[model samples]
Target: MLKVLIVDDDKNSREVIKLALERIYEVEVALNGVHALELMKKNSYDVVICDYVMNEVDGIEVLKKMRKSGNNAVFILITAFGSSDTAIKAIQEGAFEYLSKPFKMSKLKQILAEIEKSLSEKKKEEAVETNKDFEDEQIIADSPVFLEVLKQMARIASSDVPVLITGESGVGKEVVAKSIHKYSKRKKGPFVAVNCNAIPPSLLESELFGYEKGAFTGADKSKPGYFEQAQKGTLFLDEIGDLEFDLQVKLLRVLQENCVRRVGGMKDIKLDVRYIFATNVDLEQKVAEGKFRADLYYRLKVAEIRVPPLRERTEDIIPLANYFIKKYNFYNREIRLSQGAERLLLKYRFPGNVRELENIIRASLIKARYTGVIMPGDLGLKEEHIKELNREEILDALKKAGNNRKKAAEILGISRATFYRLLKKFSIE
Candidate 1:
């Protein structure tokens, strides 16, 4: 069942919707938009049915904030004070549906059924989604070099050998680790992950090896550490280069012996975990500098896989941008990247790699809510070619292109989506 939230200031109205939807959906009710937004931060709702009129923090303000912050749930606005202007503003602000107060229960159910059916069909389509516009997979690229990396990863996923994944930050090292576990014989086993740099060094040992009851002041009960937690599965150790020199010896021993001794415990426990290590730094250099253990470095490098930075694979940029566009695009109109937008995206050197590219596209999508077109301005980019284009110039360019979308975009120095947006803005069609 899809999760739904109903926000209304009137208690009776809230109960009416809540009672109507609770059996069909995982329904939640909030007294007003502020309470609804606070709950939004903690839960992912499939649909938000909000009242347009409220004492404070009205639904429109909540909707704008939600879109700005990347919440892509379907929003249905209901108001007793409905008018053509209210409906138009709702559509412009990305409301999926609008309802007038005192509407029939059957109408609401019909809308709910439609939402459910659409979501079910999309879920079916995505059961085997791959290499399309979706970006849930950490590594989604068509570059020849990246394809070779995938081939290598697929081949290496079957073995129990220790794997070292090296790459620049945001190059998706952890994603590679998860893929290894997903294809291995231990695919059904748990996959545990940790960042060596994230946890403080003082607490890292107890966290890794676990501890017995009363092992420390706060150790009231026995707990299995990351090792035991990952038993019979994969354990991804991210940023392994940040491991303290002292703890490196213990980690090496566990790798060598396949056993661990819990803190304050006398007996050693055998472990069956497959180790996958990732780092953005040079482990060899760290060893040479006497900051990291040379033995551990060599041990982790038994099977090494290196990922190239995003800038190195220029061909993947457009596909990646389109992927993010599909991910965060929620407007009624279809959004597309202009040739100009693509050129500018390709021209920039993404110092933060794929993560930065994702951020840029997500932000652009939010900015393109009204236009349904990602412009250079959405990406904070500037180009001289189209700086002087005006409404008449754009209309004249469209007329010159014989109303062809691609040619019109070329003439106006914008993307096809932008051309369509301009047509709507001018009421041309």
Candidate 2:
């Protein structure tokens, strides 16, 4: 629901406005500009309504202070004495809509409706702009490993090749996929991404191939899947190694034929999508273990790109850290990582890779909001964090188990003796 703040010293005026707007919005009341500012600091409001003839801080003064403080909420000044000059000034100073006192409820409702529609359109525009910014960033990398990957991506992005991206988890493979789509001839079209590891095998196929109306139980309506949505664009398949064997064959057929037949439907749909598959597993090893199909692996590896883990690219740490600090500084006005914090970040071997670095930076920024400068203590990385996992096997187990070691070993589908030996080797209790 839209929230509105009403600032008027006159109790009757506040009550009248509240009565009219309460059913439509979440209404908040403040007697003066000072009280309104305090409420704004603690929460966000969609619109602010203030009386023009207040004693200390008038409506114009309140609007000026709000603008100076970077408050983007829409403002509507209520004045008993309305003038063309005053309305012009309000518009120039970023007041969204101006209202004269003793106005009809219908007019107020109409104005509120217009403001809501405008805000909705603005939000949609902002979302598009933010996605464009992510495209611009494109996961900055110049390391030898990334450069080689970029070269491969550039080569395949222009073609209709089924390119597969192999890398460790959180190594920015999705970013690489997006970069390929952005630079490709399909840049004008949509780029769709789906996590194969996240969805179950039963749902994964439906998600990819889409479904016709009444295709299956709970399949209420006809829907276009990733392939249909990504027509003339790029379809990014993240964690492709996790796809079940049956779905693998179906996916392989779709890649080979450039057509897909939805589940419970006989008709085939031709797709003109560039496939960009990503996996954090060794496909060859998985094939040898009978977990992944060799034929499917070969097809996806027609064009390959591997993103190096964070530990392998230590040189990018400080630069990436500073980048995140500056990026987050927009939201948090006062935040900077100290030299000690930077050193601590660099020294740690980030097994969780770029994602972990981002989380650490976000956590530090929150800490900095309260303490001014982000220090080592703000990072929350002490001896306990170090002791948790200092060995590769234990760390690998933790990741496989979703950071739960005992469950990881249980599903290792590994023998107890071997699991204990591995744990001991890793000094994991």
Q: What do the candidate models score in CA lDDT, each in turn?
A: 0.81, 0.76
Best by TM-score: 1
Residue range 186-281, candidate 1, lDDT tens digits: 999999999988999999999999999999999999998999999999999999999887899999999999999999999999999999999999
Could you list the CA RMSD of all candidates, in the order they appear? 13.6, 17.0
Show where candidate 2 strays beyond 4 Å.
Answer: 1-137, 330-334, 370-372, 382-429
Model 2 residue 128 distance off true place after TM-score fit, in angstroms = 28
Q: Which stretches of candidate 1 lie over 4 Å from their true place?
A: 1-135, 330-333, 381-429
Model 1 residue 74 CA deviation in Å:
16
Taking all chains together, each candidate's TM-score versus the true structure is 0.61, 0.59
Q: What's the C-alpha lDDT at position 129 in model 2? A: 15
- Across 217-244, the per-residue lDDT of candidate 2 in tens digits comes to 8999988888999998889999899888
TM-score of 2: 0.59
